[model samples]
Target: MIMDIIKQGGRARTTGRPRDACPYPADSRERRAWFEGYDGSAWELSTRVPHPSVALRGVSACPDAATVSNQAAAAT
Candidate 1:
């Protein structure tokens, strides 16, 4: 399986390696960052992508969610 390089700490998932194979020392901020990245990437692997039609409904955010929603609300 091709490994996906994770974003936060620029780490990659090596084939046959456990998801918890973080190089950073445990109980450290770096480890926490890696763990957070693992959490997100793992979740991404499991969840289905948002429907393409969502963007047509203005669910595609620009800048940030709150700002876009506020702008949309104001426009209505």
Candidate 2:
């Protein structure tokens, strides 16, 4: 997996390694940097080619009922 490290007040860095690479060893610079600006909510993962199963699931799921109800109310 390609890892992108973004630190506050610093340029983003990209690190390429095998998907199974160890995240960090104890007492490593990477570990320290990760801890300094780790914001779980700001992180996201995306792919250009999604799996077939995921696409199928998304298509099959129902749309938000509340949104449909709100639109109906507005129309009336």
Go through the candidates in order and give the C-alpha RMSD of each one to the true structure: 10.0, 10.5
Cα miss at 69, model 1 (Å)? 25
The TM-scores of all predictions, comma-separated, are: 0.34, 0.24
Which pairs in model 1 have colliding backbones? Answer: none
Candidate 2 per-residue lDDT, tens place, 1-76, comes to 1134324312212243332343556676555444333322122243123334455676533358767988999999
Best by lDDT: 1
Worst 10 residues of 2 by lDDT: 8-17
Runs in model 1 lying further than 4 Å from the true structure? 1-16, 41-76
Q: TM-score of the candidate numbered 2?
A: 0.24
Instruction: Return the TM-score for candidate 1, rounded to 2 decimals.
Output: 0.34
lDDT scores in order? 0.52, 0.41
Q: What's the lDDT of the predicted structure labeled candidate 2?
A: 0.41
